[model samples]
Target: MSTLENDSLRSALASTPRPPRASAASAALTFGWRGMLKVRHVPEQLLDVTITPVMFLLMFTYLFGGAIEGSTGEYLDYVLPGILVMSVLFTTVYSGVALNTDLTKGVIDRFRSLPIAKPAPLLGALLGDTVRYLVAGIVIIVFGVILGYRPDAGVPGALAALAVTIVFAFGLSWVFTTLGLLLRSPSAVMNAGFMAIFPLTFLSNVFVDPSTLPAALEAFVEVNPISILATVSRGLMEGNAEAGDLAIVLATAVALTAIFAPLTVRLYRR
Candidate 1:
């Protein structure tokens, strides 16, 4: 290398100042805003939230309402909570898929180069995805109302139900975000997510009474976390919420965050 050019490079390095450290909250919100911008630019990113709930609410209520609950009205009341849970579950996978895509595209590398909180990108993506989850809940409730499904528990009850679902959903996102960091492709993450979610939400007492299942399967359904969550949502929205169901839902959220949050942060830093 030429001496003058080498000295110039050295001088430039010596003169450059490092960027200041960003607070965790600020960094997370910054990246979160970025995540929302991505959704804005790609409007189709909301198909799951916008279209899936309508289809599921209509399909499930009409197809199985009579056979399962003896009437469409009764089934609508029973299934709407389940559908809300399902909607959030469906959207949570996208957090992982989106993260995987960002990693693949070298976006993480850019974030790494910046002077920001290490967990900012991940936490930000999750925060941004909260919008999707909220929209899903609103869509299910609004559409169900149009189809003659009313929450007898009223607005307060409905809001409480949504609050529980959102808390659970936020904790659940960590599991998938970790998967995104570990997986080779977004498709793999999505497939694994659906495989896990479909069974948990479906096999639980979401659509039908757990008593109807075979002895062993019914046992699992009775204690399934999703089942507990759905039960709590139904109770809250229907004015029959029990302390036991609320306790179970809170415990599940705590357990999920305890187990997955550290693992996700570890993988994210890697």
Candidate 2:
């Protein structure tokens, strides 16, 4: 190397101040913004997240509303809450798929190489996914409004219901995030996630009344955590949420986060 060039390089290094380390929150928010950017570039990813709920809402309300709840209007009111739950929950599956994709593509390894909180990537990814849940829920509620389904509880009630649903989705996302870390492929993560969600949604009071089921099945449906969540959602939007149900829903969210979040961190570290 030329002496003049080497000295100039040394002077530049000596004059430039080293940037301070990023705070944990700052690092996490940066990754969360990165996650949001991915959605911006790949806006097509929202097709499934949106289309399913619209289809379910329309099909169920028109096809079976009269037979099930006596009319489409009444059934719209009855089924919208359940549809919101199903729609938002379906979006959670992608959290794992995205995480798995990052891992497979070595994006996560690049995050690991950065000097940041170890859990920041996972937390930020999950945080960004809250947008998907928001999108799904809003689509259902707005469509339901267009279809003449009104939340008797009005705006505050509807907002409260949406808030609870988002919180629930947020808590449940850890399960998929953990799967993302453990599974070898994004497809596998998705398959396994929907396998669990489908049964929970179908078996719950999300669609039909538990009364229509066989006694044993009805008992199971009544006790199903998904059923409880749907009931709470229904009640909140409908303005009749039982205190006990709300407590149970919050407690369940806490339990899921408590169990799966640490497990995700453990697996991430490994």
Candidate 3:
């Protein structure tokens, strides 16, 4: 084409108006779907939500159930809720690992060039990771049922218990998301997250009764966030939901999100 025609085409393109950046909610969901697609491409990413939970459920129930609660059946009743909490907590580490991978690999650089909300990637990762927790919840419930475990609170209660756990896990992901941005490697993110969460899950009332612990340990368990979560889940699923325990769990989630969400945003912007 002649220079005149090329100049005319360039002028027309420059005059065209582009749409505004998408709303944070819409961009978040879109990127969230993208995150889910990543899971499809890497099926082994699901081992934490699937294989790990099943193994924990089986090992904990059969091996130590009788010793801890005097019979496998009775222990299964008491253990399912706590195991569900533990499963989701353990799986949350993957959020940090995935986020760190994206950052280290320069995926975030491509995102920066796009006209989307800055927070979309982080929110999307957290939203997508909810599916992982949901899968773990289902695995635990199905295995518990097959093993003769029954929730006294029935379906609605069990669902409420799952919802509570998912919400808490969602908030907790921000803590790791911040680590993913600040840390140099995905492995470092995983190690740091595990170091923070392992003691919270194990030292709390997840595997055993708080009363059975020593005085100092029991003191920590009583106020431990995991203990609050386990108590809320057990109470809700067992038809004894206490207003106080549920309140504590909800408060803990809110506090974690409030503390870490801004930190993650700040670090990611840097």
After TM-score superposition, the amount by which residue 14's alpha carbon in candidate 3 deviates from its true location, in angstroms, is 6.1
Instruction: Report the poorest 10 consecutive residues by lDDT, candidate 1.
Output: 12-21
Whole-model lDDT values for every prediction: 0.90, 0.90, 0.91
lDDT digits (tens) for residues 40-66 of candidate 2: 899888887788889999999999999
RMSD of 3: 1.7
Better of 2 and 3 by TM-score: 2
Q: What is the C-alpha RMSD of each candidate to the true structure, in Å?
A: 3.1, 1.3, 1.7
| TM-score leaderboard ranking | 2, 3, 1
lDDT of 3 by residue, 1-270 (tens): 999999999988886677877999999999889978988999988888889898999999999999999999998988899999999988888888998999999998898777888888889888899988999999998888989988998998999999999999998988888889889999999999999999888998888998999999999999999989999999999899899889888888999999999999888888
lDDT of 1 by residue, 1-270 (tens): 999999999988886676677899999998889978988999998888989899999999999999988899999999999999989877999999999999999988898887777888888889999988999999999898899988988989998999899999998988898899899999999999999998898899889989888999999999898999999999999899999889988888888888998898888777
Candidate 2 at 92: error in angstroms?
Answer: 0.5
How many backbone clashes are present in model 1? 0
User: TM-score of predicted model 3?
Assistant: 0.95
Winner on lDDT (1 vs 3) = 3
Models 1 onward score TM values of: 0.92, 0.96, 0.95
Model 1 — TM-score against the truth? 0.92
